[model samples]
Target: MSLKRFLDRADESRRSLLVANRSSPDPILNVLEATFDDQPVRVSERAVPDVETDTVLLVEDGEVLATSPLSALRDTIVTVNSDLYRTGAMGIDDLDMPAVLERLDDVRFTLRGYPKSNTEKLLLVVVSRYIEGIAWQAGHGRHRASFQYLSRIKDERGTRRVYERLAETDVDVHVYGRPDWVPSERFDVTTHVGHDADFRDSWVVLFRPRPPTPDANAPDSPSTDHDPVALLAIETEPHVWEGFWTFDQSLVADLDAYVAREL
Candidate 1:
């Protein structure tokens, strides 16, 4: 009975969460799968210097909220947004916090590409001006078999909550730190994607929880008594066989079960 309720709630949450800005689906390329039945041969990275062979573009942004700093990210195959779009919105210096929060909650943020190098970290410094509140997000391009298999129904924010709890039980669990990102950093954060960040044949993507800020009525009140935490991360991978899945079905099942039990 509890499992049924959990599933229902998860579905409803997925629908409601993307209510305002769910129209568009802009995903970065994460997988590199190729097939040639004729020649029966194709090229893929992995031997070494895989990241270098994959010539990809990145989009990044930084924002400074009340008393906190944050940086948002998106990486894609093609370049998105010119220099002006990224440099303009350094931090909410003059915008109304109430209005800004409302805009963010609505998910109207435009994709500006993901961070590729440490150089972009300079833009994060702008967050120093804000009074409080911080949140950062990023979308790794392409889908590997490992990443795409994650829970589809959960929002980015919910994923954070899931990971945090799982950390108690799982090993090598590296989640978002800095107590909610930091100032003068590409993403206000740097989640450890495990020691072996290999997602070639599979898919890997990341999401973060929505930033918690004071409400219009209560300027100091936030969603929780404490700060936000990076929780769950869902990943999807392809199947090895023509129709069979390539990822560890047991692990994927565990993730599904975990979400069912928790959120």
Candidate 2:
């Protein structure tokens, strides 16, 4: 059945419940699935045939996942990030952070295009800033120095180089969300249980979580005309560049505070 029909059915039930893609494991879908899990919400799946037909809540994409719905349902929120409409608007390019860092010389590097994977590029920018910060402090005769990094997710190879470079410098490093595999002496570590925090002016990288696997016992949801995979790229952009971090007050504030107090 069409999504509109589903929503219409839901309206008749007079419930505040929401629906999500059941069969697709897209990040947004997963978020909704998790949010509504065990709650009295409905879901649409492509893997198994939906047994609930009559009075079924029909849902449309914009009605559930986009701005209009959220605005209508929630109170006003102060946002430091980009506007909702601007999300996923940036196109993918061919930039690579590791290569840029290799060529970096105290001078700035130019972007030829956005890379297919910009995670490394984002790391390069942050590490470069840390390097610059350390140099500035040393020149001013500051005996103590440190750079703090707050990462929402872990990246081994990309961050390894960052840790190594900082380790060689005069600056001490503190990493939030450090993984178990990372050595202790490499940098100081801290724990942050908050949902969000601030960082200094730097780059950012974004990622989409992999979808969950289908259950063998669950009903098979028929595939619709909508393509879930196509939306993944756009959803993962804000977390991958130097300029992007400027918009995140949490990251910028935290990094600035650490520098002021520690270094």
RMSD of candidates 1 onward, in order: 18.6, 22.5
Specify the poorest-scoring 10-residue window by lDDT in model 2.
226-235
Best-matching candidate per lDDT: 2
For model 1, state the Cα shift of residue 209 in Å.
13
> lDDT score of model 1?
0.22
| Superposed model 2: Cα runs more than 4 Å off | 1-154, 168-170, 177-194, 197-255, 258-263
For candidate 1, write residues 59-106 as lDDT tens digits: 113222211111111211112232322343322233222221122221
Supply the TM-score for candidate 2: 0.25
Count backbone overlaps in model 1: 54
RMSD of 2: 22.5
